[model samples]
Target: MNSPVVRLRGLTRSFEQGGVRIDVLRGVDLDINRGEIVALLGPSGSGKSTLLQAVGLLEGGFGGNIAISGTDAETLDASGRTELRRNHMGFVYQFHHLLPDFNAIENVVLPQLVAGRARATAEDRAAELLTALGLAQRLDHRPSQLSGGEQQRVAVARALANRPELVLADEPTGNLDEATSDRVFAEFLSLVRGEGSAALVATHNERLAARMDRVVRLHEGRLQHQGKADA
Candidate 1:
């Protein structure tokens, strides 16, 4: 766990809009160790999402090195990147993005099934995660029936369903009320820690960010340390 689960060195990303060049990430360097939870704090449009996209291997045109679990992302082709992502990464967004037709447990189970886990095994994993997240009684409830916090909890369960080595969350609790956000984010932190997986959570809430193991602020396309996180 001492070594980095994910490492970024000299990362850079830019875009051209209306003939004006905009740099989102510029020579950023970071390391996220196994079992560590890191908070990424920044206001909207601060390149937090772009940094996450690079780490998630969700896009191209990023220039730099992204090494995850000892594999360099630049070394993999499209299919290989997809395989790496499927095998090692999970994601949660500002929106829950649960499958409307599926129940809470099913939403979590589907990802495991896609990852080739046996149906029984997948169901068991889903049940364990949802139950731990306090959704035991609502396993069969659809997203439409769940409250906002419950829906986000299901999303957190789904993100951890495959036992991903790294979970990337972007504004995960942004949609909820402060009370709901605190509860949901606390559960998310607990679940991620329990699984022994590293996390990079992007959030604008200083209150929420302060709870992680470490805090990094994204400013002007670079990351600045904000000191150690809460214990």
Candidate 2:
């Protein structure tokens, strides 16, 4: 088997409230391999998002080790971490945070542009991805002009725009209705798998979680009760 795209060991996070310590994550060890899609399931306040944040390199104040694509995040400074994320990580949230000003294609194109790709090339890639996601006709539509599902689809396209090695999503379908969520999720899974990027997606829906390659539950500040998908 290939090495993990994401590895965490002894990962822990805490916060102080009223001179009392609240432990969110306590020593979480996980490995997500290349092209694997792992589902994270937990109740609200279970620290699922905290774990994703740590692996995504979105914040500091975390204790223990986080390694992404073989590089120990602890060894990188703030700027270095930012560079690592830019080159190797993609993120999707419950909300489609698309820039209302830009059209679907442009929202997707912006990331590649920031990565220094030529404007023409970036636009081409964006169109290709959006088209594959069934958004070819909607490419010119702005976020407000599209339906909720369409907006989320555009967000999915944007997340994969950089073709990052790992995709970290915190309830990417949470805000959508069931039917829309299912459709969008199927599209998201197909696109991510087609790109061969490992993904760690957090969701509360058991049916969706079961569809993934594996499922893990967060309980008492640790990952527990891991289960594999049906063959």
RMSD of each: 1.5, 1.3
Q: What C-alpha lDDT, on a 0 to 100 scale, does residue 104 get in candidate 1?
A: 94
Output the lDDT of residue 89, model 2: 90
- State in Å the error of residue 38, model 1: 0.5
Instruction: Estimate candidate 2's alpha-carbon lDDT, on a 0 to 1 scale.
Output: 0.92
C-alpha lDDT of residue 16 in model 1: 99
Model 2: lDDT of residue 144: 95
What's model 2's lDDT at 131? 96
lDDT tens string, model 1, 1-231? 355889999999999999999999988899999999999988999999999999999999899899999898888999999999999999999999999999998999999999899999999999999999999999999999999999999999999999999999999999999899999998999999999999999988888888888999889999887666453
TM-score of each: 0.97, 0.97
* Each candidate structure's count of clashing pairs: 0, 0
Q: How does residue 211 of candidate 1 score in lDDT? A: 84
lDDT of 2 by residue, 78-171 (tens): 9999999989999999999999999999999999999899999999999999999899999999999999999999998889998999999999
